[model samples]
Each structure stands twice: as structure tokens, then as C-alpha cells.
Target chain A: MDALVIGTIIKVVLVLLIVSALAGFGTYIERKVLAFMQRRLGPTHVGPFGLLQIAADGIKLFTKEDIIPQHANKFIFSLAPVITAATAFIALSAVPLFPTFVIPESLPLIGGAIVPSVIADVNIGILFVLGMMAAGLYGPLLAGMAQANKWGILGSARTAVQFLSYEVVTGLSVLAPIMLVGSLSLIDFNSAQAGGIGSWIIWQQPVAFVLFLIAGFAETNRTPFDLLEHEAEIISGYVTEYSGLRWGMFFIGEYSNMFTVSILAAVIFCGGYGDLGFIPGSLALLLKVVFFFFLMLWVRASWPHIRPDQLMWLCWKVLMPLAVVNIVITGIVVMI
Target chain B: MFEQIAFYLFSFLTIGLFLVTVFSNNILYAMTSLAAGMVLIAGFFFLNGADFLGVVQIIVYVGAVMALYAFGMMFFNVTKVVKEKNTSNLLVLFLGVSIALLMVIMFLSPIVPEAIFASVPPEPNATNPEAVGMVLFSKYLVPFEVSAVMLLIAMIGGIILAGKKMDQSLTKIEDEIISEKDVK
Candidate 1:
């Protein structure tokens, strides 16, 4: 019992550290990618190649003044960022980072079980992630409403609607993969795709993969689906009223979610951490991670934000039916 | 024993959140409370040896349904709406409490006679998807088909309701443009 408690704590801490670092690096990468696209140096001022730029930004956010609007709901305002960052962090616990690195034992204390490589390889890991993502909407929604600003409310409204609409497609898209693997545990799903490139799920369920990717972008509030914070209209959206570390939490939460979705896409379709004999598995995993991260940046740089109606139409009219078809096809293939 | 403990814990959490959902004045707070409650209900399903159902509950209820509720609340102009009161009659509340107590007593009265204190054993290989699929497709096929149809209808309904408003606004814009052209 004591060991289990300690292991859970350790796992939580490790996950937090890894996710925070990923978020920081993701921010750095986004800046560099955007800069490169715009033909300029991104961040040459902080450290070597601006690597420490994230750390410097962290320091600035932490040391900066924290402000609360006069008419804001103080309690909900304080809680919003906490909910956002915390939900994003918790979702990582269920994601299998590597194929074989899961903490094996069901007990909390034993950090290294010979089992799969995840924090808690729960039987319903996928559901847990979905639940966490669902809970994640609260932070922005609450933050926007509590701010008493019209822009914040509008931003929050857009985010809520956009997320809810895309979530259906996300759920349906994942169902095809789940049905094919016959398991809800992400670790099991990853293992089922163990063979190199040929065994990747994307080959079999290309439509589902595409749908999941698009829904994921929407879920993470990335550009091309970022109607929530359309700068030409609502400045900073739900984050308009936040400043200092509070705002930083929302920013970090966004990056972390982006990383989470990329990692998920890697795991689900890109043969997570799988090496096709060209490089070591760990290196392959890192390459995949970096590749997906760059892909996100590329999309951000290349695509323009979709209008709200277009975003909704893409989900309902385009992705939803396709996801349903993917699931039926997978079912038939499995039976055959 | 652990499962029993987990069941009770999840039940308590679910009930607590449900109460908060009912009592909270703010729609957002109520929705959050309801989401938390639904998640705990999923936990309860897990304890009941329904792993697949538990996951589905979490994914569909807490993920999709609750998100819709929260988004609806955010978009609707509910700032000036007053909170509703708990207006059940005293006699009705008393009757409800008494009836619940009586049902609990009656259910436990028979079980008490058997001295059933042993922990319920976990089902072997209960996590296998094949078993779940077989039962779901064979025994529950009718209900399953019904649910699929219902969901399809709901999807169509959502699209119509949400899209119609946008269509109206677009038509209004077109009409205004045509009127401006005529004036010019």
C-alpha cells in the first residue's frame, strides 16, 4: 500500500515534468517555425540557438504581475487555469509514451512493472483520456464567462461550440481504431501495432486517421480551426482577461494539449515509437515526436483559420459520416 | 474487497456531485458538477464489472454530451436568468424520503437473512472485448440498433437546430445586400 502510494506520486511527478518540458519546447518550436515561415530569426536572444528561451519566458511569466479584473468571479477565475492545466496533465497519465515502458504493476508504489509503459494502464484508458479532455473545456468556458468582458464571452462561446462539435468526430474516429484493436487500453492498442511501418493502423484505416487528425487539431484549438481566438475579431478570446502566470498556465495548457494530440496521432497511426530498422526505437520515437510537433507548426504556419460555420460543416458534414463509414468498414473487415 | 470499497467511494462521490449539480445556481457550475458525477457513475460501472460500458459511459456522456451542455450554456444568453427554487412540497419531500428508506429496508431485509458478507469475486477474463462484442451484438442487438438509430436522429436534429440559425442570419445578410443594391 505504501509503495503503491509512493509510485503513484512518482508517476504523477514524472508525467508533470515531462509534459511541462514538452509544452515549453513546443512553444519554442512554434516560434521558430513561424519565424522561418516569415523569413526571420525567431529567438536568438536567450540561450544557444534560443533553446533556453522557454525558460526565460517561464521566469518572466512567473515574476510578472498577476492581475484580476474588478468585476470577475474571483473564485472561478482562479480555478479556471488550474482546471485547464491540471486536466491536460492528467490526460497524459493514460497515454502510453513508449510501447514497453509502462509501469507494470497495478499497485501504485512499484514504479517499474514488466507490463506496458504508462502511468496507470487502466482498463479504460481511452475513456479516461476522453473524460479528461471533456473536463478540459471548463477552464476556458469558465474563464471567459467570469471575465465580464464581451470578447471573452464570445471567445469562450466559440471555443465551447467548436470543441463540442469536433468531439463527436473525435469520438467516432477513435471508435474504428478501438474496434479494430478490440481494446480500450491505449497500451494494448499500441502493442497491437507493434510491427514496423507496414503494421501501422493508418494503412488500414486511412480515413479514420485523417478524421482523427483533423478533429485533434480542432480539439487543441490550433490554427485552421482556431475560431476561438481569431485575433482579427476577438483579441486573445477566452484568455483576454488573464495576465502573468495565470495567462501562462492557459498558454502552457494549449501547448501541452497540442503535444498530447501529436503524441496520440503518433501512437494511434504512426506506429508509436516504432523503428523500421533504420534507427533505434527510442530515437525513432523521438523522431516521430519531433516530426509531429513540426507538422503541427507547419499546419499553423500554412493554413488560415476557418470560419465558425465552415468548422462546424467540416465536422458534421465531412468528418462525421466518414468516421461512421470507417467504423462499419473496420467491423466488416474484422468479421471477414 | 477492494472493488466494494471502490464502488462505495464512487457512489458517494457521484451522489455528492449530483447534489451539487442540483443546488448550484450557476449553469456552468452545475454542468461541471454533472460532468464530475457522470465520470463517477462510469467508475461505478467499472466496479460493476462492465469495463466496456464504463468506458463508453465516460466517453459518450462526460465527453460528448456534457460538452454540448456546457457549450450550449456558454452560447445562450442566460446572464439575466434567475435561479429556480427547490419548490417541492414538504409533504412530497417527506414522502420521497420515507419511500426511499422503505425500499432500502425491504431490499436489505431479505439479504440480511442470508448473512451474505463475502466479497463478490471478479469475473475472470472480463476485460476481453470478444465477450463484450458477442453479448452486445447477439443478445442486445435490438436495443443496440435502436440506440444507433436514435443517435442518428439526434445528430440530424442537432445539425438542423444549429444550422438553421446560421442559415437565417445568412439569408438576412443577403436580403440586406439586395435592398442596398436596389437603393443604389
Candidate 2:
């Protein structure tokens, strides 16, 4: 009993630490990418390679004055960022970092340790991730509504609609992979991609992979789908009233979500940490993650934000139909 | 023992969130509460024997359906005031409570044999993935196909709703633009 309790605690801490680091780096990468695309230098002043930029920003946010609009619901405003960051962190628990690297000493620290890669390894890991992602929207939605600002409300509404549309595509696209693998556990999904490069599910289900990527980008509120924060219209959207650490949490949550989606894309399509039998195990996983991170940065730099109606149309009309077809095809192929 | 405690805790949370969902005045709050309830229900499903069902419930209902409902609320310009409680439905609330009680009684009466519960099922061989595939294709093919059709219908319905509204708004704008052009 003691062992299990300690183990779970360690797992929770580990997850938080990893998520924070990823979120920080994600911010740095986004700024660099955006600057490069616009032909300008990005945050080069903070530290070497601007590596400490996020850290400096974090410190600044923490030290800055927290001002609440007199009319805002203080309780809900405070709760929003907590809910957002918490949900993002919770979703990462089910994602396996490496197939065998479970929380160290989580199971008694004995020799020949069971390298459990995930926190829970629940049977319905995919579902859990999706649920958390849905729950995650409350942060922005509540912040918008509670702030009693028109811009906040508009941003909140746009975000709500955008997420709803993409979520369908995300779920359906995931179904194609789930149907092929016949298991919902991330571990099971990763292991099934065991053979050489050809065995990767991405090659087998390219359409599903593409749909998943597009839907993931939309789900994370990345560029080409970020009408919620269109400066010309809603002016910073849901976080308009937030300042200091409170606002920082929202940005951190966004970056963490970017990492989460990228990691998920890697796991579902890029043979998740699999070395293709050439590179070593842990290194292979790291490479995959880095590769995905770059892909996300590349896409961010290249695409312009789509209009709100166009975004919805693309999700419902284009991605949804394609995802359904992918599922049908995967089911047939798997059966054969 | 720990599992039992965790199960009860999550079950209570699920019920509490469900109550919040029904009682909350704000539509967005109600949807958020519903999402929480769905997640806790997924926990309940995990505690019970239905692993896949639990996951699907979270993915489908919480992830997709509830999200869509929240989006609908936002798109339709629903505010907290719009979701205010209807005081005219006392009898309906009574009926709802009674129906819920009836369902609890109806479903909780069956007890699985103790012998089955006492023994953990041996871990099936990894090859069972193939067996699952075979069974799904051969036995569950009809339901599988039906689910596909159902999803297709839902997709088409959403598209019609969103698309039609968008086109109407666009045409209205186009008409104004054309009128201005003629005047110019």
C-alpha cells in the first residue's frame, strides 16, 4: 500500500515536470518560428540561444501585479487557468513516453524493474485523452463568460465552436487507428508498430494520419485555425482580461497542448519511440519527438489563419468525411 | 480494497457532477459539468468490467457530443441568462427523480456469480488481437456497419445546419455588396 501510494505520487510529479518543460520549450520554438517566417529576430536577449526566454518570462509573469477587473467573477477567473493546466497535465498521464520507461522506482525499485511508460495505462487511454481535452476548454470558456467582456465572450464562442468541429474529426480519425490496432492502450498501439519502417501505421493509413494531423492542429488552436485570437476582431479572445501569472498559465497550457498533440501524432503515426530497429530505444523516442516538434513548428510558420467559417467547413465537410472513409478502409484491411 | 475505495469515490464524483449538470444555470457551465460527469462515468466503467465501453463513452459522449453541444450554445449566442432554471417544471423534476430511482432498482438487482468475480481471468495470449479482429468482422459486422451509417448521418446533419446558416449570412452580405456596387 505504501509503495503504491509513493509510486503514484512520483508519477504525478514526473508528469508535471515533463509537461512544464515541454510547454516552456514549445513557447520558445513557436516564437523562433514566427520570427523566422516574418524576417525578424525573436527573443534573443534573454539567455544563450534565448533558451532562458521562457524562464525569464515565467519570472516576470509571477512577479507582475495580478489585477482583476472589478466586474469579473474573481472565483471563476482564478479557477479557469487551474482547470486548463490541470486538464492538460492529466491528459499526459496516459501517454507513454517510452514503451518501457515507467516511473522510476514506482514499483518498489527492485532489480529487473518493470518499465511502465505511462501513469495509468488505462484500457481506454485514447478516450481519457479526448475527455481531458474536452474538459480543457472550460478554462477559456469560463474565463470568457466570467470576465463579463464582449471580446472575451466572442473569443470564447469562437473557441467553443472551433474545438467542437475539430474534435469530431479528431475522434473519428483516432477510430481508424484504434480499429486497425484493436486496442486502445497507448502501449498496445506503440508495440503493434514493431516491424520495420513499413510496419508503421502511418504508411498503412496515410489519409487517417493526415486527418489526425490537421485535426490536431485545429484542436490545439494553432495557426490556420486560430481565429479565436484574431487580433483584428476579438483582440486576444478569452484571455483578454487576464494578466500576470493567470494569463501565463493559459499560454503555458496552449504550449503544453501543442506538445501533447505533437507527441500524440508521433505515437499514432510515427511508430512512437520505435527505433525502426536501427537507433537505440530512448534515443529513438527522443528523435521522434524532436521530429514531430519540428513538423509542428514548420506548419506554424507556413500556414495563415483560416477564417472561422472556413475552418468549420473544412473540419465538418472535408476532414470528417475523409476520417470516416479511413475508418472503413482500415476496418476492411485489418479484417483481411 | 484500495480499488474499491477509489471506485466509490469516483462514482460519487460522477453522480455529483451529473447533478451539477442538471442544476447549473449557465449553459456553458452545464456542459462543462456534463463533461466532468462523463469522465467520472468513464472511471466507473473502468471499475466495472467494460473497458472498451468506458473509453468509447469518454471519447464519443464527453469528447465529441458534449463539445458539439457547447459549441452550439456558443454559436446560438446562449448566455447564462438563457439557461436560467424554469420554475414551471416541479412535476417534471418529480417525474425525473422517480424514473431515475426506477432505473437504479431495475439495473442493480442482478448479481454476478461469486465464482466468476473471485478469479482474475488469465491474461490472454497476445495473439488475441487477431481473435478480436476475427470476431468483429464475422459476428459484429452488422452493428459495426450500422454505427458507421449512424456517424455518417450525424456528420451530414451537422454540415447541413452549419453550412445552410453560413450561406444565408453570406448571401445577405453579398446582396448588400451588390446594392452598393449598383449605386456607385
Candidate 3:
């Protein structure tokens, strides 16, 4: 029990450090990807292939002036970014990232510690994750509200409407898979698809997979659905008044959410971390996450932003009904 | 030991947040504190091992409900301090005392019914959600269905109320725009 607690602490620390670094790295990758798509060299000045760009950006963000707007609600304005970053990490607690392993018995200090994949193996893992992510809307909503800028207010309003609407689609789309697996735990979903690529829930619930992907994009505020900060529409949106580390926190939160959504897609729909021929489970999971991340960037490069009204229409009139029908079909099939 | 510490910690925090919600002059602060209190109440559900209920509480209350409230509250001037209406201290005290007494009774009532709890022991092997499902679908099914029906009715009512004059309002502005264009 003591070892378990110690292992969890280590895991939590590792997740925070590694994921934050990855989020920073993700920005560099996004820049490079976008630059390549636009037929240009991205960030070649910093280091080889601009590998040091992330470090430079980190230094810049850290050293920059932290400005709180004169008219802003000082307390909630500061509290907002922390909420964003904190909730994003907290949501990751239930996610089973990699497979579990035990330390060697011969190891000195933390020997024989069995580290689980998830930080907290809560029985209702999926719901807890969704709930935490759902709770994450407060970050932007409050940030925009407290900032006292017109753009910020608009951004918060968009955040509320967009996040709240897509949340329904997200839940309903995942319901089909939940029904098929008859378990809310991601590990259970992983094991249920352990038979291999053929047994992936994606094949059975294609509509759900599509709906979930669309909603996931909206939930993470990715391009096309990224009306919250659509540069053309609203000038920096919620982060219009934010500067320095506070702004950086929102960026980190977003990138981490993208990773979370990607990982979730890989785990639930795709054969999560399952071995494929010579490729090991961990490698497969990594490859899948990379592909999903690339897909997001690719879509950003290729697609144009949808209008807010169009977004609302698509979510309500189209995606939601489809998700509901898919759930019904899956339910009937399961019952049969 | 961990559970005991968590319970007391959550209890104090929840109470503090509720107090903030009640007494804060800024509507934003009040709403935010209320939302935080709701989340902490979910912590209590989690501590009780009702993980499903806890998650539902967070998702429904903190995520969806408070979000709507926040959205509406955003339209209000947050800078202005909301003045509380004057009330008799004795009446307020009486109401507070009665409410506290009622809550105490409700809490004690559950513990006093040891026999009722023993009569319907939860399945040892079943997970929390599964056990809840069993009871909800079997024993309390009627109440559950009735409440669901009630909710559906409430939803329809809300939609009707909101949608009633929406188109007319939209066209009213549109007609005003057309008339101004003609005048130009």
C-alpha cells in the first residue's frame, strides 16, 4: 500500500513534467508542420531543425512581463490560467497512458513497486475524464469574463456555447462504445480490443468514431472549430488581455487537451496500446498518438474555420442526432 | 485514516465556500464559490465510494448547470456590489435555526436506520455503478422513471419558453434594418 502511494506520486510528477514538456514541444511541431504546409522553413534560427525553439519559447514566456489588465478582475484573471492548466493535468489522472510494469526486486529504494498505467484506477474512468474535461470550460469562461475586454467577453461566450454543446455530442458518441464494451474503464476498453486490429471498436462504431473525432476537435478548440480564439474573428479572443506565463498556461492546457483527446481516441476506438505483429503495444500506442496529433495539424493546415452559427448548427442539427441514432443502433444490437 | 482527513478537509472547505456564496457582494464571486462548493460536495460522494454519483455531480452541476449560470451572470455588471435587502435579524435567525435543525435530523435519520441498511446489503462483488444500477432499475424503478419524466417535461417547457419569441425578435430587428435602409 505504501509503495502504491509512492508509485502514484512518482507517476503524477512524471506525467506533469513529461506532458508539460510535450505540450511545449507540440507548439514547435505545430509551427514546423504549418510552415511546411505553407512551403516555408520554420524556426531554423534557434538550433538544428529548430529543436531548441521550444526552450527559447519557454525562456521567452518565463522572462516576459506578466501583465494584468487595469480594468480586469485581478483575482479571477490570475486564477483562470491556473484552472486551465490544473484541470487539464487532473483530467489526465484517470487516463491509462502506457502499460503497467513492476520495478526489479533487486533495485535499492523503490524496489518491487508495481506501477499501474493510470494514476487513479477509478472504476468509472471514462466519466471521470470527461467530467474533468467538462469542468475545464470554466478556465476559459472565467478567463474571458475576468479580463474585461470585449474580445475576451466574446471569447468566453463562445467558449461556453461551444464547450457545452460539444460536450453532449462527445458523451453521446462515446455512449455507443461504452455500450459495446459494457465498461467505463479505459483499461477494460483496451483489454476488450486486445484481440488485435480486427476487434477495434472503430470498425463496429464508425459513425461514433467520426462524431467523437469532430466533437473532440471542438472540445479541444482545434482549428476549424477553434472559434474561441479565431484570429480573424476575434483578436486573440480570451487571451487578448493575457500576457507572459498566464498566456503560456492556456497554450499548455490546449496542447495537453489535444494530447488527451488523441490518446482517448487511440485507446477507445483504435486498438489501444495493443501489439501489432512485431510492433510492441507501447510503440503502437505512440505511433497512434503521433498519427492523431499529425491529423490535427494536417486538418488545421488544410481546412478553413467554420462560422460559429454553422458550428452550432452542425453540432445540434447534424452530429448530435447522428450520435443518438448510433447509440440506439448499438444498444439494440447489444440487446440482441 | 486518509478518508477521515479528506472528509474533514472537504467539509470545512465546502462550508467556507458556501458561506462565500451566500455573503459575497460580487455576483461572480458568489456563483464561482457556489460552483466550487458543488464540486467539493461531489468529493463527499467520492469519499462515500459512490464514484458514479460523484462524477455525475461534477459533470451535471459544475460542468453544465453552473456554466449556464455563469454565462447569464456574465451579462450582469460584475463591478457593482449587489446590495442585500434589509431583513429582520430575528426572522433570519429563526429560519437559519430551523433549516439547521432540519438538516441535522435528516443526517441522523439515515444512521438510525441500521436495520433498513442491513436488510438491503449491497452485493459485495458488484462495482458501485453496477450496484446502483441494480437498485435503481429494480426497487426504485418507478421513482426513477417518474423523475426522468419530470425532467423531460421541464426540458420541453424550457425550450418552449425560450423559443417562443426568438424568431419574432430576430425578424423584428431585420424589419428595422430594412426600414432604415429604405430611409437611407
Candidate 4:
């Protein structure tokens, strides 16, 4: 029991540290990618090709002044950011980081502690992750309301609509794959796709995969669906009043969520941490994560943010119906 | 021991928030508190090892429902909704307290019958959602279908209510009067 408890604590700390560092690194990659696309040098002077720039940014964010609007709800404004960052990290607890491992018996206090890939491989892992990510909506919603700015309210309203509508599409689209795998655990999805590339659920449920990806983008507030904080109109939206670490917390939440969705997409549709030919399981998983993360950045660079009305229209009229049909068809096929 | 501690923590939070939700004069605080209370209940579900239920509770209640509620709250102009009430607060307070106490008793009686709670007998260590699905589809299919049909009806009713043709559905007497007036 002691070993189990101690091992779990170590795993939790490891996940929190690594995922956060990767999220910071993701920003650098986005900037570099965007810079290259726009023919501009982005953050190159800080370190070797700006590699340590994220570290510099972290220092700046931490040291920056924390500002609160005079009329704002003092408690919730502060509470909101913590909720965002906390929920994002909490969601990671359910995500399978890599394959499970049994500690060598030679280790002292926690010898032979068999660590599961995920921190909490719950029976319904996907649902738990989705729930946590969905709960993240409150961070922005409350933030906007608490900020007491017109733009903040508008941003919160957009966040509510975009998240609520896309949530339906996300759930429905994933239903087909969940049905195919016959389990809600992401590890099960990985195992179901273990028969190499051909066994990937994406090959069978391309429509669902596409819908899920689109909804995933909206859910994460990525570009083409980033009406929540479009600088051109809403003046940074729900985060208009926030500064310093508080603002950085929202960004971390978003980037971490982006990572989560990428993992979900990769695991459920693309082969997860499953072995691909001579490549190992963990390496394959990492490659998929990189691809999905890059895809988000690429889409951000290429696509324009859709209008709020258009986002709602697409979610309800196009994606929802498509997801439903995909589910029904998959259901029929599975029954056969 | 762990479960007990967690249960106490979550339940305290849930009830504390619920109290604020009811007693607070500020609409926004009340609504926010309600959301917090709902989320804490989801935590309670997690502590009970109802993992799927926990997730669904958060997703459905806190994520979708409370968000929608917040959106509705934002849509209404606050000044219009914030008009002070001039009712007899003292009487209302007494009645409210009594009703709340009655509710506490009613809710606790079945589960807390004995000195100890051996009430909630443990089921097998099967996947909960799967077991729920199986039993719901097999034994309780009728009630399940009935509730589903109820929801469908309510949804259609809402759509009809939201339509613009209600005024055009005047009875024959009104239609005849309109025609007669036009003829004159």
C-alpha cells in the first residue's frame, strides 16, 4: 500500500511537470512555425534559435504585475484562472502518457510498484477527460463575467455557445469509435487498433474522425473557432481584464487542452501508443502527438476565425447531423 | 478512511455552496455557487467509485446545463431583474427553515435508518456504466422508454412554443368577424 501511494504521487508529479513543460514548448513551436510562414523571425535571440525563450517568457509572466479591475468581482476573477489550470492538469491524470511499467525490485521505498500508463486509468477514461475539459469552460465564462467589461461578457457568451454546441458534436462523433472499441478507456482504444495502421478506427469512421477533429478544434478554442478571444473584435475577449500570471494561466489551460484533444484524437482515431511496424509504442505515440499538435498550429496559421453565427451554424446544421448519421451507420455496420 | 475523508469534504462543500446558492441576494453569486455545488456533487460521485456517473454529472450538469443557465442569466439585463422585493422576510425565513429541516429529515431517513450505514449494499466489481446499461435496457426498459418519450414530447413542445404562427391560429368566430368586417 505504501509503495502504491508513493509511486502514484511520483507519477502525478512527473505528469504535471512534463505536460506543462511541453505546453510551454508548444508555444515556441507555434511562434517559430508562424514566423516561418509569415517570413519573420520569431523569438530567436533568447537562446539557440530561441529554444530557451519559453523559459524567459515564464520568468516574465511570473514577475509581471497582477492587475484587477476596480469594479470586478475580486474573488471569482482570481479563482477563475486557477480553475482553468487546475482542471486542465486534472484531465491529464486520466490520459495514458505511455505504456505501464513495473519498477525494478531493487528500488527502495517503492520497489516493484507497477505504475499504470495513466495516473488514474478509470473505467471511463475518455468521459472523465471530456468532463474535465468541458468543465474548463467555466474558467473563461466566470472570468469574463467577473471582469465586468462589455468585451468580457461577449467573450463569455461566445465561449458558452461555442463550447456547448461543439460538445454535442464531439460526443456524438466519438460514439461511433467507442462503439467499435466496445470500451470507454483510451487504453482499450489503443489496443483495439494494435493491428497496425489498417486497424485504426479512422479508416472505418473517417466522417466521425473529421467531425471529432473539427469539434475538438472548437472545444479547445483553436483558430477558425477562436471567436472567444479574437483580438480584432472582442479585445482579447474574456481575458481582457486579466494580466500577468492570471492571463498566463488561461493560456496554459488552452495549450494544455489543445494537447489533451490531440492525445484524444491520436489515441481514439489514429493509432495511440500502439506499435507501428519496427517503431516502438511510446515513439509512435509521441509522433502522433507531434503531428496533431502541428496540425493545430498549421490550421491556426492557414484558417481564419469563423464568425460566431457561422460557428453555431456549422456546429448544429453541418457537424451535428453528420455526426449523427455517422453514428447510425456505424451502429448498423457493427450490428452486422 | 480515505473515502470517508473525501466524502466529508465534498459533501461539506456541496452543502455549503447550496446554502450560499439559496441565501445569497446577488443573482450572479447564487448561480456561481450553484455551479460549484453541482461540480462538488460530481466529486462525490467520483469518491463513490461511480466513475462514469461522475464524469456524466460534470459534463451534463456543470458543463452544459449550468453554462446554459449562465448564458441565460447574462442575456437578461441585470437592472431589470434586480428590483428589490418587499415581502415579509421574517415569515418567509421561518417557513423556509422549517421546510429545509423537513427536507433534511426526509432525505436522511431511508439511508441512515441504523446506527451504521450497511444500507447501500455493494454490487459486484463489474463496469458500472455497462451494468447500468444492461439492466436499464432489459429490466427497466419500459420506464426508460417512457422517460425518453417524455423528453421528446417536451422538446417538441418547446419548438412549437418558439414558433411565430400562434397568433394566426385564431378560432372560427374571430375569422368570421374579420371576414364580415372586410365585406362591410
Top-DockQ candidate index: 3
> How well is each residue in B103-183 modelled by candidate 2, as lDDT tens digits?
997677565444245233423553333444566677779998999999899978986885665645453477878789789
Name the 10 consecutive residues with the lowest summed lDDT in model 2 chain A. Answer: A102-111
Q: Model 3 off-target regions past 4 Å? A: B87-94, B103-120, B164-184
Please give the C-alpha DockQ score of model 1. Answer: 0.35
Local error of candidate 1 at residue B114 (angstroms): 6.6
Best by TM-score: 3
Q: On residues A1-336, what C-alpha lDDT tens digit does candidate 2 reach at each position? A: 676567767878977887787777778887887798889889898789788998998889899999888877676778889888888888888887776754456445554445577777776677678767777877887788778788988887787778778887888888888887878777778888877578888888888888888887777777778766777778989888899989988877877777778778888887887766768666777787777777877876887777787887788778888888888877777889
Cα deviation of B165, candidate 4, in Å: 11
| Model 4, runs deviating above 4 Å | A104-111, B67-98, B107-125, B161-184
Q: After superposition, how far is residue B61 of candidate 3 from its true place, in Å?
A: 0.6
Off by over 4 Å in 2: A2-5, A101-111, B22-31, B63-172, B175-184
Candidate 3 lDDT tens digits, A1-336:
676677788889999999999999999999999999999999999889999999999999999999998988898899989988988999999998988777799999878877788899999999998888888878888888788788988888888778767888999999999999988899999999999889999999999999999999998999889989989989988889998999999999999999999999999999888887799888898999999999999999999998776787789879998998888888889999
Pitting candidate 1 against candidate 3, the one with the higher DockQ is 3
* Model 2 residue pairs with clashes: A102-A115, A102-A116
Docking class of 1: acceptable
Q: Per-residue alpha-carbon lDDT of model 4 for B4-71, expressed as tens digits?
A: 99889998889899999887665667777888888889887788778877888888886555565565
Q: What is the full ranking by lDDT, best candidate first?
A: 3, 4, 1, 2
State the lDDT at B81 in candidate 4.
27
* CAPRI grade of model 4: acceptable
Model 1 lDDT, residue A247, Cα: 92
TM-score, candidate 1, is 0.85
DockQ of 2: 0.28
